[model samples]
Target: MQEGVIVKALSGFYYVEDGQTIRMCRARGVFKKKGIIPLVGDKVTYTPIGTREGVIEEILARRVELVRPPIANVDQVLLVFSVKEPELNLWLLDRILVHTERARLPGVILFTKSDLLENGDECQLWVSAYEKLGYPVLMVSSRTGEGIEDVRSLVNGKISVVAGQSGVGKSSLLNQLSPELRLKSAEVSHKHGRGRHTTRHVELLRLASRTYVADSPGFSQLEFGDMEPEELAACFREIFELGQQCLYRGCLHETEEGCAVRPAAQEGRMAPWRYQNYLEFLSELKDMKERRF
Candidate 1:
């Protein structure tokens, strides 16, 4: 048996890369019987049956796992957001950031379509805000080929997953970095300003010698599954830290007396939009808890 990583899995066949070559393999019967299906990014042992073909013998442990794209052992998430066409969705971005934080993955925000940002101040403001939070933010335009080097440097030598809403130019950016991708790109609707979904499944692509990029379908609605109301605050690092300073021990940080989070937002110490999303997520958890009973 040879050790390799499952770079791609499609239609019940896994393409395991053993450094020298890729072997098309199927999971051993033991995996199905044990209910442990292999996923892309999983390190496994497989026995070669023929040229470019093998049988997966065992799946090794994973460092991280994501549900939406169903990838494992991801190093970081590249949160792509467009500055103009689809317009920025701060709420959705915050939600995704929180989810990445919960998964213990570092997130880098990529603002695409820099060429469309004629009013540079607006773009600067958005970049500054995220930068203040200590997150690495990049502004890139595939058409202009700006900031592609910086993005390439970040993704090089790591397995990074790119995610964002439809029309954010995730695939275009990928193509810009590695022209070999030749991935499909859709134009934004003049009426809705949203681009159509072009990527159908999640697959890992080798952009460079040691760099891997996972391209997945755009997300329209983001759901942070199974996070409790109390646990939700932890996902929002900024708010969670302020909540710790609240006078009340068990403060929900919403309309409560001596709520530190509210006061911080009112004082402009924290973004009000982020606080509002926290309440929305908390409300969803509360509703779920009530329904369970």
Candidate 2:
């Protein structure tokens, strides 16, 4: 028996890495009987059947799991977005951040193509705003090699999931960080204003010793799953914090009387766009609840 991590799953086979070598593996029949399906990023114990093949006998406990891409033990999510090209969709960014918060995963915002921005005043504004809200923000350009080292330092010794809209340069950045990866990348379509989906599936690539990153398939929209309307505000850190001072208990922070969060947004103490997104999400969640019954 040996201990290793399952780095990739393909066509009913799992490729497990045991530091020295990778072994093609299959999960034990007991796991299927017990309704257990192995996922990439799962740590497991396996028995070597041959030089390069094995059987996974036991699955170690998982630290975390993401539903959309279905990867496990994720340490953080690098939410990449382009400052140009497709343009910065802050609404989309905020929606993803809310999901990350609900999953209890740390998320870093990476604005790609810094070199393409002729006037970065708007980009700088967004960076400052997110940073003020205590989220790690990095402006990276794979072509110019800017902010690559900062990204490397952040994902060091952690299992990171690189995710965002298509054409935000996720694959390019991964290639820049780890050239050996040679991950496929595509240009954004000028007609559609979106990047073609180059990454077909999720596979963790080791960038450094004990540091793994997964380049996930790009997605533009996501639906909230089984979350209450009241829980939405808590996902926004600044809103949740300021909401404590609201005069009324159980305030949804949407035009409520004496709402501290609304006042903070009005006074420029909080990002108004983010606050507006919060209200939008709150409304969406409310509508979802109404549709449930």
Candidate 3:
């Protein structure tokens, strides 16, 4: 048996890369009996059948798992957003970031299409704001190769997943990093102002030894699954850190008296947009909870 990582799973087939090459494989039937579905990024051992094929013998332990798009053992979330084409949607960005926080995964913000921005003021402001919130933020133009190396350094030896609005250059970024990928890309619809879905499935593409990246389907709609309304605060890094300043216990930061978060947002201490997005999300969660009953 040889040890390898499952890089792609499609139509009951898994592509496991053992560093030398990616071997097409199928999981043991026992896994299906036990309800053990394999996912990309899962480390496993398999028995080689011939020169380039094998059967997955076992799936090793997973470090972390993501519900939406269903990938496992992800080390980081690459939040790719385009600045121009479809325009930057801060609401969607914050929405996804909140989910990342909920999963306790480090979210890296990569703003694509830097070439469209005539100036860096907006990106710099966003960078300064989000970076202060403990998320590493970067601006890159795949067309110009600006800040591509910085991105390369970030995902050098890690299993990072690329996510963002469609046509935001998720595939383009990966293509730039590893041109060998030649991943298909589409243009953002001029009429609808959103890119058509190019990536239909999740597959991990290897960039270097021990380094892989998964360009999953882009997501514009994400729901907070099974998370309580009160759990939203801890997901926002700024809220989690500044929440310690709340005067009262069990404070939801919405209606609590002497709550530090509202005042901090009111006083420009914390980014107002972050707090506002939190309120919006909290409202959505509350609405969902009410609908449940």
Winning model by lDDT: 2
Candidate 2 lDDT by residue in tens digits, 1-293: 89998899999899999877889999999998999999999999999987999999999999998887788899999999999888898999999999899999999999999988885357788999999878999999999999999999999989999878888899899999999999888989999889888887778888887789988873456889789999998899999999899999899998888989998999989989999999899888999999999
TM-score of each: 0.94, 0.96, 0.96
lDDT of 1 by residue, 224-253 (tens): 567778888888878888988898988889
Clash list (residue pairs), candidate 2: none
Model 3 lDDT tens row, 1-293: 89999998888999999999889999999999999999989999999989899999999999998777788899999999988888888888999988888788899999999889985447677789998887898999999999999999999889998878888999999999999999999988899998899888778889988889988874456878778988998888888788898998777788788898999999999888889999999998999999888
Using lDDT, rank the candidates from best to worst. Answer: 2, 3, 1
TM-score: model 2 vs. ground truth: 0.96
Off by over 4 Å in 1: 218-220
lDDT of 1: 0.86
- Clash totals for all models, in order? 0, 0, 0
| Candidate 3 global TM-score | 0.96
lDDT at position 190, candidate 3: 96
Model 1 TM-score, all chains together: 0.94
Per TM-score, what order, best first? 2, 3, 1
RMSD of 2: 1.4
